[model samples]
Target chain A: MIAGSALYQTAVELNRRAAICIPEDARLAVGQLCQRETHSLSRYVLEQIMENYQVAVAEQRPMCADTGLPRFYAKVGNEAVVEGGMVGLEEAVRRATAEATAAIPIRPNRVHPLSRKDQNNNVGVHAPTVDYSFEPGVNWLELTVVHKGGLFGGDYRMLFPADGVAGLKRFLLDSISEFFRRGMSCQPLVVGVGIGGTKDVCVRLAKEAACLRIVGDRNPDPDIATLEEELLELGNSTGFGVMGLPGDGAILDVHIEIAYTHTGGMPIAIQHFCFAHRRATARIGADNSIEYRGNPCWFTPFYRRESISFQPA
Target chain B: MNNLEDLKLREVRLRAPLTEDDIRSLEIGDVVFLDGVLFTGREGLYSQLFDLNLQPPVDIRSLSNVTFHCSPAVNELRPGEYHIPAVSATASFRFDKYIPLLFERYDVRVIIGKGGMQKEIYQSTFRKYGAVYLTTVGYGLGALYGRGIRSVKDVHWKEELGLAQAMWVLEVENLGPFLVECNAQGRSLFEMANAEINQRFEKLYAGLPQPKLKRLGEVTSPTCEVL
Candidate 1:
């Protein structure tokens, strides 16, 4: 079994560190998307991105909007057991959420779906945007941060009338093209395509797909993997490159996750995660020793980004 | 974003028994060059410091230091901008309570941050306690790098929230040249758009509820024991 308190502490420290480090590249890409002027300090998208970042930064908090529909993907082996052999994801997420909450000081961004009301921190009986559960394995506890911040500008239900796979592909490609041709002020957007029976699964899966890839990585499927390459070419062909370069290779590194379903109807779920994908951690050892990897950079930019004025409160 | 090499910042510690030069010389746009031993203590840290009633892990009262109004970053990715390992959870509201006490007990010179203080902080603390609050653009790294900050004075803010141990390197330069935000003074481009939409919203709605703050880092907690 792994240590608890102390181990949790160190991990918390690293999580924070990662959040700090990860958001910069994402912000820079925003600059590229907006095609910021080279010398105009205030005119560039970087300034607006920075302005957005500062709100999060000065507040000394996270900038990610969706915070993802979180699901703690885990694997608790036989080695780790609860006091009287009681165990589960509820216990894991609760314990882990508590440790992370204290360590990351994560603002309670969670909310209830039905009421559209915020839970703040109480993770009450109501469901959350994040779903943390179990995986049978061992090693005390190891956690990963996966968030698909909702930047739909509206709701996920707003879809283009699903007409199965063939028609749906047209709908999907068009949206990707619109995002690219229009020149996104937000870039390095992780696009996840979820294909399966139900809409919720595909949508949830799509958001989760973003977490599947590391910052500088790609997708894992073969057939859809080919589609990813094609989508990548189409997006890059639009002349929207890394950071919005006319010559950038790919506008998006697309990832597709799929599950089998009946032949009658096909549902596609698409989730767009901002480039500022953020995550935090806390590792505790058996000795009550804690190493906290709180928020990292690159998650939400703060320092000298392109600035934008705010509306009067 | 300028390269890390391009960004320059200076760090200095704080001291008490205010001198005329320290008080008068400080103004709206002057850049500071500081270096020496200083420590961090917002409300939380301040309480801890008062309770501890001794030189804690870090040194305070040493004029040899400058306290940044902005949060310290973990590392530098570029000039003016750096990798902030943790989000420094400092809200002026929280620290205002302890500033007077901090100045009274310790020698603090420069405080760096956005919207430092109003007449209340200045009249009571700056004038009475021989202290002044400096405004580093409301929210951005440009101010940190503006004028010219060279580097960290030493290991600092090791105890505050948001990546306590991560190193934040500050640089100095022309921040105004790099960023211009939509602020109270009505400078941000965003304000223009938001205002237009708001006008329409106001007409269509009444008795609207206030918008709440949204943030990330909400759920990094371990996944549930079961799905």
Candidate 2:
């Protein structure tokens, strides 16, 4: 059985890693963007961003003070056993979040929506939301911590089938125009588009696409991959760069995730993962051996399977 | 595309409690680094000082003339002592209403934050007070900015306002890479950038069809800013 203590320890370390380290994929993408960025002002901003990333890791401090909202994604092996079951696992995560908040000194960003009461520990009702998915076979549990800024760069709309790709492109442009001006969304962003599904599902997918996926990863489906490329090109073609300054590129990449939805509606949600791009992941084996990596590897084929039954090859 | 070596931006380093001439000398797009002192403030401090009309516990002007829209990631090593590991600016547009009072009451000459206030506010409040707005580079250079902070001189209203919203008096040196978004003369670099970007929107959106359903509060004009 995987001990609760191990889970707690791993969770705390993941939070620290997420806070201080700019993942390699994101760092490389920014470095490449810096080279390609043409505008003098935007290029300077990109260079500063890269310098900030290096300083964060070297100083062992958070890359951004807004540590955003710290949250988790867990992928469980079907046969994995935990010391305290699901409740035990959740308790460990909650406890770890509070501990990491104090130790890493991440801003305690959580509070009561109405009363605005802060516990001063980044722990509160439904704070540090933990989302779970399962794999067909395996005996390890993987966790990914993402600290995404809560304000700006997210939107949802219901489009009819008649609206088609043209309408989708318009919606993408609308969201960009709304937030990209004045650099409200903090550009050189990863644009995540979630298409088809219930409203909530699409929103969740958009956030996952933005936060969970690495810089160069693409959807396995050919059609979706093509759309991702098209959107990436379109988003960068806007002549907006970092801080909405006139430049060659604003978007780092576009990730699209789809789910089956009602026949009449083609619901869509979009989320922007900013230049900060903080996320980290780890896997805990049944033997309690832990291995950390940059990519979350969240979208397993089984998780996206259309078939009712999942088979492990 | 210009070569990286060919592009050069004018960079300046200024000390706090700046004079009218100091503020006036700055122009839009000038990169700046700050020294001396600045304090952190946001909605909580604004609501208390402006909305509730509470007198500052300490004389506001005595602390510094520069104010930052930020909350650092702080650790209280012991009671009454703190360590800040990182600092970054929050979006300033949301606090636009308080700018006039801040300039009038506190004699604030420099406002540093993420993004910036609406363009008209620059022409009105900022121009009236001979103030300028500087935006943090990348808007998330928390560690780089944090390194500049020498000490947390004082913290106000931690119990009442919570850590993130409390008034933090910080002493900083070389604390920036901030870009002048709005100059003393009221010209906004972002507004100028927006004007150029907006000119391309029509062509970019030409081939795309309008949405099937329109939202009530959405801004339809490509040129109009949502803020």
Candidate 3:
């Protein structure tokens, strides 16, 4: 049986790393995007983002000031053994969140939804929210933590299935345009679109797509991948550039995650993540051994494709 | 389209109790670099400072004429001392209610944040108080902490508000490269950017043919969880 103490240790370690450094893959993608800036203002802003990452690494500071909301996605093995079961895992998360809040000193973002009371420890009602799935044969638990800063934006819509390809495109474009105009989402933006699932499933998938997927990677299905490509092109065409200045590098990538839904309704969720996209993944074996993986590989063993061109319309 | 090249730029040295002439000289799109003291605070601290009628722990008028909206991530080195670990800009629209009140009571000549503030504040309090709004590069928080800030002075509200929400008196040097968003003359950079995007959207919408949707089957009510 895995010790309860081991779980808390793992959670603290994961939170610590996710907060302090931008993932290696994100660094590579941002570097490539910076090289494509044609406008002087866009170039300046993009370069600063890169420089910020370097400083975060060098000084061991959080990559962004907004440490954001702490979210966990886990896949637990059905056969896995734990000293206290899943409840123990939940308690472990709470303890770990508190530890990290004091240690890493993440912003205490949790507050009473109505009373506006600050917990001051990043733990409150339904906080450090957890989503998990069970795999029957697996013997180890894998966890991915996504730190979504407060500035990120998202929405959900239950569209009539008849609202064909045109409706989908219109909805997506309209949302992006509104955010672009308001300068809501930070640029070198990452857009995550979820389609065809129940409303709850769609929203989670969208967040997963936004935070878990690598910047330059694509879905294995050619059709879904093509949609991602088109959206990326359309998004950049807005010329929102970096921090709402006019330029070409408005969006760095678009990710689409799909699930089968009831024919009666097509639920869609659009989630936005800033360029930081801070996340970390770790695996805990039945014997209590922990392995911290570099790349999240959340949905691995997928087909690889050539990188799409980002030419603005 | 707004052109950055045509924007008038000025380099101003920051100090407390700025003259009316200094505030008025700045206009929308002007670039500024600060060279003096500044302080940091965010939503919660604003509530405590103004709504709760708490007196500032330090002498506010002695510092520069600027205040930044940042709830920094800090690490405590000793029992009371701390070091800034990260810094980032936050939105100012929600703080609209208290900003004017702040200007009326204090000598704050310039406000800094990301995504700018509302237009009413700019047209009214900013113009009336002879103040200006500045936008820092949002993604450059780490670089800002490293290059811009020199040290953190005495911190206020650390006990109740926690580290992020606590008001910090910071000594800084060359802490800017802030874009003038709202100026004393009442021009707003955000308005120009918004208008430009709207104009461009009109063309984009007109050129594209609307996509039609076809219903495949029956309707089912969805049960969505609270996200």
For each candidate, report what fraction of the true interface contacts it reproduces.
0.01, 0.84, 0.43
Task: Give interface RMSD (Å), model 2.
Answer: 2.2
Better of 1 and 3 by TM-score: 3
> Which prediction has the highest TM-score against the true structure?
2
lDDT of each prediction vs. the true structure? Answer: 0.40, 0.90, 0.74
CAPRI band for model 3: acceptable
Each candidate's interface RMSD: 16.1, 2.2, 6.7
Superposing all C-alpha atoms, what RMSD in Å does each candidate have to the true structure? 16.0, 1.9, 6.9
Whole-model lDDT, candidate 1?
0.40
Docking class of 1: incorrect
Window of ten residues with lowest summed lDDT in model 3 chain A: A303-312
lDDT of 2 by residue, A239-286 (tens): 888887888887889999999999999999999999888898999999
**Per-residue lDDT over A27-81 for candidate 1, one digit per residue giving the tens place of the 0 to 100 score:** 5545554463332221232444455465455645444322334434332333444
Model 3: residue A161 alpha-carbon error in angstroms: 1.9
Which pairs in model 2 have colliding backbones? Answer: none
Models 1 onward score TM values of: 0.44, 0.98, 0.87
In model 3, pairs of residues that clash are A162-B213, A162-B214, A162-B215, A164-B213, A166-B211
